[model samples]
Target: MNHPMVVGIDGSAHSSAAADWAAREAALRGVPLHLVHASPPLPGNAVPPPAADRLRHLGEQMLARTVADLGDRHPHLEMRGEQSDDSPATALLAAARTAGLLVVGTRGTGGFDALAVGSVALRMAMAAPCPVVLVPRQPAGAFGDGVPAARDVTQVVVGFDAHHPVSETADFAFSAAEARGAGLRVVMAWALPAESVSPRTPAVTEEDRATWEDQEVAQLSDALRAWREKYPRVTIRPDVVLLHPAEALLNASRGAQLLVVGRRTDPQAVDGRLGFVAHGVLHHARCPVAVVPHVD
Candidate 1:
C-alpha cells in the first residue's frame, strides 16, 4: 500500500499552515494527501443522539472545506479528509503507521502558547512510525523565487552528534535533499571534552581551542562522508559549533527550508524522549522541523 502524506487538523491558524504545507509536500512527492481530525468521544450516553450528530457534522464540515480549498490550490493533487473519534495523539499515530510523512502545527487549538511543543504534537513527534514535521504558525521557509507564486526550496538542514551518529537520520535528510534537488546543511555541535575542563588541566590556550575545533570539523566530515558519496549532487555544508547542540542547530535552522533531527525509539518504553536540542528546535525554530525516529 502506498502511504500518503498526513496532516493533523484542529481548525487553528497553525494547523491551517500545516495543512497548506502538507499539500505542497504531497504535490512535491506526487503522493496523495490525508487530513485527519480527532475529536474526543462525548461523555456517557447522556447526550442526545442529535447532539452527538451535530458535533460529528461540524467536524466533517471542517474536513470538507479543507479538502475543497486545498484541492483548488493544488488542482491535480489527490486529497481526502476524515474525522475520527479518538484523542489527537492516538489518531495521528494510527495515521503515521501508513503515512509517508506526518505534519503538525507548532500549537493547536488546545495547545498552550507558553509551551513550545504541545502534548499531542510532541507525543506524535516522538512516537510516530514515520517522520513528523512541526510547522510554525506563520507560513514561511518555502523556498524558490519568482513572482505570482514561488516554490519551496530543495534546501534542508540536519543536526548530528558525532559521538552518537545515527545513519537512518543522516540518510533521511540526504534522501529528502536528493528528492528536492536542494543542498544539505549538516550541523554538529560540541564543547570541550570533560577532561579538558577539569582543574588538573591548565587553562586551555588558543592553540588548544583551535585543535579542538579542527577535530570537530573532521568528525562532521567523517560522519557525513557516506551520505556525500551517496548524493554527490547535494551541495554539503558542514558546520561545527562550540555551543549547546540545541542552540547550535536552532541557530543554523534560520532561513532553512526544512530542519531535520533525530529521536531515539525505545521499544520497551511507553513514553517518548527528545534531546534538549531536538526539543528546543521543535518548539522554537522558524521553519518546519522534521523529527525522525532511530533505534540505538
Candidate 2:
C-alpha cells in the first residue's frame, strides 16, 4: 500500500511541528508516515575522511529519535526515517513524487543566519511533483508565532485566482472539508489600479475603475457559479475584498484549518512556472498552504 503522507524533517522546532502535523494526518488517513532528513554532500575537491562517518552516524541518531517519538505518540502508525546526502528540498521533492501527500515545515534546521521557507518553500511549492503542504511551525496567528493547541479542526479555505485552475483544488478542498464535517470558504480578491493623478483635475474618477471592478466581479462570479451549483450541500462563503490577492487570501486563511492554492508554471518565470500570488501565499501564508500543481 502507498504511504499517505511523506514528511521532510530536521530536528528544528519547526520541523518537529511539521512531523506532528504529518503524523496526525497519517493517523487520520490510516496510512504510513515516511520521515526524511537530508544533508549536502562534501565538496567535490575535498578529500574523503573516516571522521566524516560520525556525521552520518548523527543523522541516523536524529532520525531514530524522531521516529521513536512519533511511534510512541502514535502506536498504530507505521513510521520510518531516512537521511540523505542530498539537499533538503531535493530529497523531499523526490519523496513527494510518489507519496499520496507531501508535508514540510515552513522552516527547517538550517543556519541561524538565514530565514526559512521565505525562499526554500517558494521553490518546492512551485515545482514539486505532487501536492505540497508547507506547515507553519510558528503559532497560527502570524508568520513567526506559535498557535496554542486547539481541537483538530479540518475546515479548508481555498484561494481562487483567474489565472489558477480551480477545479482540482476545489475538489480536494470540498472532499477534505466534507470528510471532516468542516465548513468551506471560497475566496476571491480583486484590486483596482490607482486613479490617474492629473495636476489639471483635483477630482478622482471612479468610471474606469468601476468598469474594471465590474469585470473582476463578473469573472469571479462566473468562476464559482458552477461550483456553487454542484456543491450545494457544502457551505461556501464567496468573498471579494479590495487588496493584493495574496494578502486577501492570507487574511481569510487565519481561521481556516487548511489553505489551498494552485501552482502555476508560467513559461516566463525563471523556473518556468509559479504564479505571483500563489508564490507569495506559499511563502507567507500563516497556516499550512497546499499547492496543487497543474497536471496538464
Best by lDDT: 1
Could you give candidate 2's per-residue lDDT for residues 1-296 as a string of tens digits? 25468988777887888899889878877888999888666676363655467666777898899999999999999888889888887888788777878888787765453554745566677667677788887534443435543433355888876545468777767765665567787777776554445666555467876787777777877877777687666777777677877888877887467888877554445453677887777766667788877654
Model 2 clashing-pair count: 7
RMSD of 1: 3.9
Candidate 1 TM-score to native: 0.90
Candidate 1 lDDT for residue 29: 80
lDDT per residue as tens, model 1, 1-296: 15799999989888999999999888888899999998777889977889888888888899899999999999999998988898888999989889989999978888566876688888888788888999987545532332221323456889987777898788878877877888888898888877886677768878989999998888877877777888898888888988888888877776677889999889888767887778878867878899998889
Q: Global lDDT for candidate 2? A: 0.74
- lDDT of candidates 1 onward, in order: 0.83, 0.74
Question: C-alpha displacement of 243 in model 1, angstroms?
Answer: 0.7
lDDT of 2 at 40: 66
Who wins the TM-score comparison?
1
